[model samples]
Target: MKRMIYSMAIPLSIALSANAQDTIPPDKLYGELFVDVQMNRIFPDGKTFVDCTAKRSPAAIVEDYTKIKKAPTADFSLKKFVEDNFDLPLAPSDNYKTDKNADVQTHIKQLWQVLKRNPDKTVAGSTLLPLPNSYIVPGGRFREVYYWDSYFTMLGLEASGETAMIENLVNNFSWLLSQYGHVPNGNRTYYLSRSQPPFFSLMLDLLAKKSGDKVYAEYQRPLQSEYDYWMDKTAPTKHVVKMPNGDVLNRYYDQYETPRQESYREDVELGAKANEAVKKARYRSLRSAAESGWDFSTRWFADGKNISTIETTNFLPVDLNCLLYHLEITLSKSYKATGDLLRANLYTQIAEKRKTAINKYLFNAADGWYYDYNISGKALSNSMTIAGITPFYFALAPKERIEKAAGIVEKKFLKPGGVVTTLKNSGQQWDAPNGWAPLEWMAIKGLEQYGKNDLAKEIAKRWIDLNVKVYKATGKMMEKYNVENIDATAGGGEYPSQDGFGWTNGVLMQLMKEYPTP
Candidate 1:
């Protein structure tokens, strides 16, 4: 979930060179423009100038405008400036208006072509980052390709028989790793300090299913680089935690200790209300939450209600560790496929050790569920969220544990629409009443792994039905759905629900293929 920034369409007549040096600091550009004008007035609530990376650089905008300041009629227009300097990316064709009379599958196929973005060869200016291969964005305000979102998106591509596009997306992520030390939250310079959930290994595994184990051999280096980024033994790597039981587990952490560039205003307002001593910590927690891919969930909040009480860095999240476990297993497999027997054995041991640690630290026998462990307090978080189901997703949970956890999910988390994100109905996008596409897929597939196909099918049917209902009503797929109320749109986020959604189309298509109605 990317933050929304406002961009205004001011009309002004100014001439400037198109080849300005791309050296302007992103934070500086954001600060200067925000101070000069009311951002909401320039761009609507969900638009931002930074969102337009293909066109102009922030330094060029600021530098050129400063030169013509003496002219009485040199009015500033962000829209006109963008038009003069940048070539905007192609938008989805609007021809696919929801056919209320058509079946859900028909509309979904239309969306696959509608939401596809061709390879971007143009270099993104200083304010924006560039990717080597063409990829599909998560749609609406999210014009750039995202990290974790692409995996679920690929599932639909695979189902749609868009194998070329799937390969392209994997190549794009590999390109990001080769260029940047790690894949950022999205293809934006402002996201450089952090990354979303590490899904590169999963992406590779998915691609290998079609391409063969040889594909792993080709990507083994990038996979190792991704792992190294997470397990880096440096002060900046706050996510790697040494537990009281002497095992190394991972948590969500971000290097930047300031307000995120995209969500600047909201972060500042929240920080202003907090004590100065804890301001940086608060910002880091917020950024860490973003990295968790559940940006504002109460699962990270100390009070489970207030955003300011977010303490993401304090806990060793079960989901993050589970992901790392997958990475280790994938790496081991890759090494074995490449004939590196010693390396494969080493990673095999690492994966086994991580599996043991996860079960030991995260599982709460009394509750019959898994929860994130708070390292400082040495207590498990009481919140019941979709994250508890991740162990089953990777086949790490024992049969007895899976059976107990499945019962708890059906009893507590299952709603009429699908599995709710969390049992607590806190006013956060990742909390109850809201069910996200990725989590829905995770819960369904995780249950299916343990031969709980009946429950999995039920969850899939309800979620797909909810998606179809919303698309029929609005002619658009949403970032998240209100599973609690099928008729109402999802709410409780910094911005309104977005359309042109990538993962929704992907997950819905995959599920429909898996569990089609007779």
Candidate 2:
């Protein structure tokens, strides 16, 4: 039996305030335009105008619209108005194309060149916020450098021997940390309120390993700023949980409960169908799940099937805590590098305590799996997902526990193509049948940590095979693969599967280097 119970006493008022802060502002310029266009010209298929809207203030846009309407010519073009007021997000680059005859490695290297983005343009109405250096985008609809996605992308960059670009990416993230106090999920102003997984420490660590340990000291302020952003109690720290034992663990959380600016229509519809009392909570949870980088998974669902039952904020996700544990360890190392042993020891102690608490609360001994602890319910979630293997990736688990987890994963989670995101086929993009690049990498590397080499190789081979098959058939690398039915294209989520796929290219390249074909 797990000794830790979900006995944290969170103030309801604080929770409500946090939710309020996360909700999209009713008077937001683009949000109002989204509702107007969605209601009138553009029906809610979830993509259309929402993706096209300028990230500007609604009141100002409304005033502009009203003035345009009162003009003598009455020739107001919404597109022109948007162009005049805001900078649009990046469109897909025309330079790159898949050559079916080219090998996957060549195609990936070409794609990397095509996906590189320069600093944001210094024009009004532009959605891109300029970074200090150029960076690689994930491709297709994601034309910006995503937070966690960059780390995986960096792995491939390193393998490709593009060390300079890797340093550029690190600088970009550090710039973000200094300017915004934390890295938003992405670079757009719309992403300011929330952050994705805290991987900045890992990013710095990678740079240090390649460059030198002095890199840690150089980036210490931004690293500490990032940590402070997560630990701040007011509004920035959304997912933090206080344990009954007076220790703290983190969870996935977002600031806005309103429909995401990108997925406005879908979020609004889901909110409409939800029970009114829990609607805001549900919406916020959905947004929080997005922050987890596993946007819509059965792991966050109460019923494991529908969107209405999403309660992401109520659970302390195992993967998130594991990442933070690594962050604490990194911080300790960074302080030690700077000759601050007292601060180093403090962070070391913090990491150790968190390790104990995570095992106590999240490890399901009876099932031999690590589950996300449901803070509100005081129990382990039933979902079996690849996230259970993350602790092993970070070498956080004991050898015996890692071996037990490997057995369970091999027996239950491994699929025809690769490891599925979760066991349940819940019609969400992050569920079974859909295998993402990041999770596959995590599972494979985690297995390798425990001498499960054969199993890791098998997973890698199958995943590479699936990637090749899809690329061969479609002439494009995808954001996610249909692991269940290799022949069928992956489906589900707010939109159709995207291409340009930064992490996909990265992980595939890294795996190819690790297990070259004979």
Candidate 3:
């Protein structure tokens, strides 16, 4: 076998020649028009307006708005003007109707076509950063490819033998990483300020499983680029944090402190009562929490009861660190495959150091679980969410600690339907009663890693059963489920529970394949 080697010095030169630049985020690009439309509630959802495709160029539209707004006519209607100038965002599954009686796997296979998006054409004023490859969106309001969501979605794609689709998705992400400094939360101008969870390495791992080891060499630059973005030495105190003992870890962060363009209205309303300093802090916390993918949860809040009291930037999240650890491990393995012993050793040392830091700061031996460390206060966070199980998923937890943590999960987190996100009923979608596909998948995999197959099986069976029951009742898969009440609908998010859900369908298909019915 020929060992293919990738040079570490090629990315900078390639990026310089690529003719692509980092997208100006929608809030900045659209200027006052963006603020006016969002603040005035021109559309029902703030996201609806931002996602719109402008008929004219963005600059022309903004110019028109500036001239028209200063001296308005009596017959002028904001809604009418918006409708004429832009094509509104559409739900991915809005046109397709489900077959209630079809087999679940069959239904999912059919849904894939409906959820798939092809290479985007360059629209003059669209927020979509055009992708060169076809990709799967998470369905409903999520019309663009998301960073972390696609990894789990690919699990089902792999199960369905959609190898080509998987390769295309991985290539698309690599393109994003190559063109921009990092993969944004989604391929949208609005998402440029922050990224979701770092799952590019895991996606590469999945691709390498189907393709050969050469896949890693092909994507070596992207892997390095993504890692560099997270561990940026320029701002050590931001995304990359140095602990009191000098152990380095990571936290979720956003580049901008302004309200997220997608959720502009909601954020403005929440921060309405605060002073400028307090509002800026709240906005920063909100944006950082968005980067976590948990979006709204008690885990980031100071009071544990209100979004206004969020302190997202003050903690070192266990899950974020665990993902970075996996990235380091993957980089080590990739370098070893290419016979670069020096680089491989460097990554191995980094991974080992990160593993030690995780155990020291995130783990809680007496409490039998892991928790986020409050960086500012210098103590472990009080909130205990399912994120603690992440270390076991990566096999980084010690055997003794794994047993205690598994016990804690079974005793406290487990519910009738499946494991709830958090124990706190904080009226957030990521909190009590809402079982998300990704978290459920994580918990099951982590449990199985430590020889806790019984608990893992139970979780899989319960989650599968709930999925089936809901499908039978509604003829649709949902984004999340209310695990505590098997019959009730999942609620309590900024938006309604979304259907045509990509992750749910993916997890259900994968689990049903593993634990099939007689």
lDDT of 3 by residue, 1-518 (tens): 22222233223224323533235556776788889888999987788988988897777887888888898999988788888999998888988988877978999999889999998888777889899888899988899999899998998998898878888888787777766667778898878667889998888888888877877767777788788878873222269889888899999988767888999989998899999999998998899999999989999998888888988999999999999999998888878888898999999999999999999989876797999999888989999999999999999999888778888888999998899999998789999989999999999999999999999999999999999999989989899999999997698878888888788988989999998987
**What are the per-residue Cα lDDT tens digits for candidate 2 across 343-442?**
9999999999889888888898987788898887888888878899988888888788976798888888888999888888878899988999999999
Q: Candidate 3: lDDT of 198?
A: 95
Per-model TM values vs. the true structure: 0.89, 0.89, 0.95
Q: What is the lDDT of residue 38 in candidate 3?
A: 87
Report the lDDT of model 1 for residue 84: 70
After superposition, candidate 3 runs with Cα above 4 Å error = 1-22, 233-237
- What order do candidates take by TM-score, descending? 3, 2, 1
- In model 1, pairs of residues that clash are 5-47, 6-47, 7-43, 7-47, 7-48, 8-42, 8-43, 55-86, 119-134
Best by TM-score: 3
Clashes of 2: 12
lDDT of 1 by residue, 239-286 (tens): 688877679899988877887777776777789977876888999998
